[model samples]
Target: MSVAATLSPAADVRADFPGMVTGDGAPWHYLDTAATAQKPQAVIDAMTRALGVDYATVHRGVYGRSAQMTLGYEAARRRVAEFIGAKGEDEVIFVRGATEAINLVAASWGMAQIGEGDRIVLSMLEHHSNIVPWQMVAERTGAQIDVCPLTEDGRIDLGALEAMMTPRTRLVALAHVSNVLGSVLDARAAADIAHSVGAKLLLDGCQAAPRMALDMAALGCDFYALSGHKLYGPTGIGVLWAREEILGAMPPWQGGGAMIDRVTFEKTTYAPPPQRFEAGTPIITEAIALHAAIDYVAALGPDRLLAHEAGLARQLRDELRALNSVTLFGPEESAGIVSFAIEGVHPHDLGTILDEENVAIRAGHHCAQPLMDHLGVPATARASFGLYSDENDIAALLRGIERTQRIFG
Candidate 1:
């Protein structure tokens, strides 16, 4: 309730990112942080150093530089463990992104545990990455998926989720926070409901990881996945955090050089959990840069970032409500993201005009086509904030929206 009050006096961290300015030296209002956050100078510098001077393959060579690179790579895993409050680095597996992380889980864990008549539970607002992978696993294994509906305010309805629970449920996967509506899930309650029915819980944490403080053990989730790019780091590197016991039991989905322990004509053996999940040459520079990104986020405090961005969402919602021509989506209280539709103007048209004002926003189904259908809309104009975002970004967005309305008028 006091989010806006707390953020009014917060320091501006926009200077940390060079991407906040346009090519013409104007302030570029980036309102698409939910898609991918702009990188800080610290993260950029770390990646440049690793890619240029310290570049080397990991877990293979016994030479000095390779040894150092391997240490850094593994250290990045430890840093991630610390950031998310995991039990250990062994519980973390590096994948391409949250997309690949979900695929890895579906292919390895879901395929192994799920069978005919088994069920998987998902929310209505899941991203395409989350939905499609589970669908593939379900199709292959003869398992079924159940979608939990949202409340009137667009939050994942926990009451409906509890009613959907049954002994037949194998896994309950949901977004920790919705990318479109910015609806924050009650992850603890969902985790409890899933476990009550002897089902494992997997959270797609791409949106929550940047906006909220995460404690893996505290959350009581069986698996958690997030993307580095959305966390203000480089792409192609993400983390899949599972309870060590669960990860140990799941078989390897990908086969390659580094994941193998010993390979022969007769049979082959795989490495331990983390290394087993990460096959071949891993993301070297990306992992190191992710460490820097986590450091930056931790210093700023994820709780503070959540409050700050939520404050901006509140402000944007209030302003948009004052405009009778606009229709807003999502709850009044949300993370940083805001989604709305202007009467007589397509979101694509509004986004194009906003781009002219150095304001960027996502204007589509936001990879949640099912949710779009549920809302009875083709697309929406979304302005999502980051740690660097402030009132200035929201002001620019409003200016562009007003301009769009006038043109339509």
Candidate 2:
């Protein structure tokens, strides 16, 4: 079926998000969803309830509220597991965000499995979170890192990636969607390539999780990481989903409460998979809010959201490409993001001018400096979409860009 045929009309959804308006009550054009999505009222209300009337520490307390809170927290885990098509709830480990999730795997699984002369594969478009952790692990383990290049149109060159893989490759980590260019990866192909080399595959799904439906089993990836804020949930919460066997084999990366089975002075054992990784007091309220966020997106339907955002991206790219001074980046049909640069205007200046018109966008290296260097620019202005984005948002952005060009000219 054509994506457009299945899409829910974008106009009907904006009213659900309170953040879509400026303080003075103007329509706030939020084009930075790739950085972090705006929260819907449903998520806010869930969090408010979790923090206020229903507040209690999870797992430790035996009281009614505590038991209820523990149930709520664990329910959130199940929701996350189902959302990602994880094998079981036990495989879902909540961390601060995708950065910490990647670090956890690097510190625990990467440290245990990677050794001298081993190789790790990453791509030029990877977010710093995915790159730095692998680098740290490689440094400690004496493993070498191989960087996959991009295609002419900015997609991760998986053909090049397959050719680069060798028996020495221990792990292959890449982003499911490019944060800078919004180029989508063929994750299943990447997985097959990694497996062909007898290497594990890890996908940073921070961008993809919000806009597309994910199935970890179908993708055949060993690990998938996602951030809550990017998924329209609260900050300080994220998920790391791995196969149960892989989680069982990896040692604990951190030492703290809740993650332990029993604490003793001499030697300490740990709890089972997910809890062992959790370590400290969990993000209880955030987890509940994440559940709500998942429900919100699910009800709206991910396929519909994908189509809506893709349509907006196509329109924005087309309009921006027609401008004489604007140079665009990424694919013709990006997941939901468009990055571009004006000939004489720095992205920061463009961002500032756009803000003056109340059209917000992201402008900078976007934490992918390697990609910036590859594109031969310091930074680009990025306009990303969400369920709330529509034709009006794109119109405002174009108007702002026209103003920017006039100011520069």
State each model's CA lDDT, in order: 0.93, 0.93
Tens-digit per-residue lDDT, 10-119, candidate 1 = 34577889998999889999999999999999999999999988988887889999999999999999999999999999999999999999999999999999999999
Residue 224 alpha-carbon offset, candidate 1, angstroms? 0.4
Instruction: Please list all clashing residue pairs in model 2, or write none if there are none.
Output: none
Ten-residue segment with the worst summed lDDT in candidate 1? 1-10
lDDT of 2 by residue, 1-409 (tens): 4343346455677888999999999999999999999999999999999999999999989899999999999999999999999878999999999999999999999999999999999999999999999999989989999999999999999899999999999999999999989899999999999999899999999999999998998999999999999999999999999999999999999899999998889989999998999888999999999999999999888888888888888888888888988899888979999999999999999999999999999999999999999999999999999888877788899999999888889
